[model samples]
Target: MTNTAATEIDDTSSAFTPNLTIDVGGAPMLYRRTGRSSHTVPPLVLLQHFRGNLDYWDPLLLDTLAADRDVITVDLHGVGGSGGQTPDNVSDMTRNAIAFITALGLTEIDLLGFSLGGHIAQEIALVRPRLLRRLVLAGTAPQGAPDLHRWSEDVYRWATGDVTAPEDFISLFFSGSDDGRQRAWEYLARTHTRQQDRDPESSLACRDAQFQALMTWGIPESAKLQRLSAITQPTLVANGDNDTMMYTKNSQLLAENIGGAQLRIYPDAGHGFLDQYPVQFGQHVRQFLGC
Candidate 1:
């Protein structure tokens, strides 16, 4: 188990010292920033996958984004540094996220969300369309909403002491990419330190709350395909070719649904598309931002 604290590059450094908490709406949330770009250029915010900690974000990839814009990567409510307190679930997560940005005093910025984060990003767009300059949805889906029922149950069991069958838990999140399943498996192996006190149990509590709150997540059930017209921001929808969970068609569906939204499908990618192809993914994001 790698602590990764000694060499941690993304969270804190003398250079990117953030004020930790912000008064967004009513919730005081934790967020980190890096790079020194001025207000002339908008900042960038990142939303990671299901139960993703800020430390879990691949450092090299974050540094890449940091070079171009001030980047904000947050641990969503009930996960990571921000997971203290009651979130109510992903629905509340959406509300808290908007507050996180608003509290930071950022009105317009580029937003990127991966996997579960993508779900939150979409909900935010619905609630506060004007707050975003652009929106990027990566390795996520508009459907397959509660298909996580069993997965959530598994998380509950795993958290309570059942060893997470790493393969079953992880295979669904990968898409065969530049490195195929081997690389995906290897990266997961390297990063998978059982955090014990801070491991899956706490996360499952949040997921259970989210599962219940999903009943009111406000994501369209018939889930209107044309709802993207309401989003007044340039959008990029992308995913890996072999994402087992959301699949490529989901990305296509989002792009097709959202007005003027562009779709980019990677040749040998999985749900961890950005991690598998960081350079290419970063380049694509830069292009989308018109940088």
Candidate 2:
């Protein structure tokens, strides 16, 4: 459906159950919109982690956030139900995301991005500072972040493994602690809640392209690293204390580099720390966005 105007259909009964689609630059982009619509505050647009689709979001977290503010979750180009080939780099991803937002007739939005999506969100804020009201980066790193290159091999190994297996998710997202493993299972359960109209699994090509973008982002030569100072949006940086995927120190770096940014680190968690502590995380996000 080619909808240039922002179309909002109310699913008041259950915000977590709706799966909607709109045309973004002539391609179908699948998304879910929930939460209380506000005239004063711009909607919170979420960008998912590597290989994650709109359905991959934790329903408890989405529902909790939606209780007060409008929450939007989308599938990036060529991932899940979105149509088009995946871009090979973060720059194009940022452009496409901007197009998606503009196509929805939104002039301002608050962005929350996780891992690879955080990288894209950073680019978006840098490229068009006027488009954002606030920014939240979770389980992510800045470009040219120290020791960023070390995680690539482990990421590749896990991504190439059986993605549908619970074990793989545990290995990739959580720490070795029993609590972490239990939270991983809960998070995985939430991901499977949308049994109908579910998005397709990310293709190998898309995964490879995302990996390439990630590697490029970690390179010191990438000019985007030097331009982070341009992102003046009120930002929140969050991650697990033991995040092996992106490393926790990067969150601190993000907070330090981005003027006035806040930082949060959850203990005994890994990359999916937000998912691990959905209630506390949701409260923090609500407080940040509300303030």
Candidate 3:
């Protein structure tokens, strides 16, 4: 009687799938896939922000993009289901990104990297130029300088493990204090942690690990910020005007160097505006991918 019903696979279809594995960094890479149809255009991959898990991405963005093309959202090493491999160095993260793509059998795809993930995106484009079509770098920078500003005192403390849970300090992450700030914070906090995602301590440890590695992570070519011109892919350096983590100039600099890169800045947002400005950002990405 237990075996009365014949076992069947999901031969029908799915609008979205979750937690698929790929081998990267000698660990199973856990990423989520959602799409309207699998046989259409090259897929869109959403790279999570610093110390962020894939669950925090705006569902509106995911749903809209998925309706037109396949979308992959992944957690980086030392985060979420990617096995939390503590990164001793920056190259490991880059290698992890490349490996995830290879494991997915993605030949050329659109990469949308947010905050910390943007750094990884740039690394991939630099090392394996053939693998990328268009790149979107949001609220990110190429290198880190110890002397530069930390997002906030609380953020600096958290990055150093001097504290956990930088609580309300994230208020600085948005310029929309009255309406947008409350709305963004609500979404961020609600989606910030998912039970299925990595626990807070592990995520914190991963954050600490990257902090040490990135302190000295240097892009000599991009130091003089010269060789950005050498990357042959069409790039989009998008940001919010009020992102204190890094200025809008970083976007401008990236655009200027990456041969005809398009720059877009949301006038009323901050670091994570990719979620807040999903439609505009998604449209911009659509155009870039169309190109």
Candidate 4:
């Protein structure tokens, strides 16, 4: 963990830094920007997991990444504080994300995407190759990977249920061991630190649409893996060794397919390894971005 004292003194650090909105195609996108903007370093734009909003991010992880450069997080359209109905497919979602970036007047950025967000990030790289300087894919898989067309019954129940309990999240994201559960509780507490002005919880519509997109992306087609060859940006692929949601093997597949991409798999962790190993992952990301 980063020193709390240092984070407190830095005005632009932490996840509680303030929510701001920008209009993209007449709809609003809720977002937060942390750390001072740098001319030399492209801002790190974060894309969230399935059903995640701005408040879903871990404060400690955000602060650690914000130590040296700007970090940005946004709610997907029709989710949380953002306006407009959610897109039901990856292509529309990719366009929505691209609109948000261009609306910010940024031509170049470093993208860090998790789960469903990682899928969209790949689309962005392929569609707008010049817009990204680097890419970080965590707990995600390439399109059409086998055994991903639909999640197992247990995961589907917790993930798409109308309400998600603490136990559900812990079971879905963290390892079953004692230490992993301890870290899961800590991560949950940190996310709830923001007392006011927090982004609203994700809606049912958002959940349904995102799950449909995931299912569509997971339909098996070996040729879809070939699409990754066009993503030539410096890439970092990482995940927990026990990711029940996306599965650990997907992360390995990503590293093997993307040319020159580096891979990291943290042991005794699950889908939420970035939060479980926040400090180490943050350091790795900072080093990769070269800020």
Pick the TM-score winner: 4
Per residue, candidate 3 scores C-alpha lDDT tens digits across 73-157 of 8877767667747675657888877778888888988888886777778878888898887788888766642223344674455
- Candidate 4 residues 202-252, lDDT tens each? 899999999999999999998999999999999999999999889899889
Q: How many backbone clashes can be found in candidate 4?
A: 0
Ten-residue stretch with the least lDDT total in model 2: 1-10
Where does model 4 exceed 4 Å of error?
A: 1-13
Candidate 2 local lDDT, 67-96, one digit each (tens): 877888888789988888899899999999
TM-score of 2: 0.91
The residue pairs found clashing in candidate 4 are none
Cα distance off (Å), candidate 1, residue 143: 5.6
Stretches of candidate 3 above 4 Å error? Answer: 1-17, 37-40, 144-169, 189-202, 218-224
All models: lDDT? 0.65, 0.81, 0.66, 0.89
Number of the predicted model whose lDDT against the real structure is largest = 4
Name the runs in model 1 displaced over 4 angstroms: 1-19, 23-28, 83-90, 143-170, 176-178, 185-202, 213-220
Q: 2 or 3, which is superior by TM-score?
A: 2
RMSD of each: 4.9, 6.2, 7.5, 2.7
In angstroms, the error of model 4 at 92 is 0.7
TM-score of 4: 0.95
Worst 10 residues of 1 by lDDT: 193-202
Better of 2 and 3 by lDDT: 2
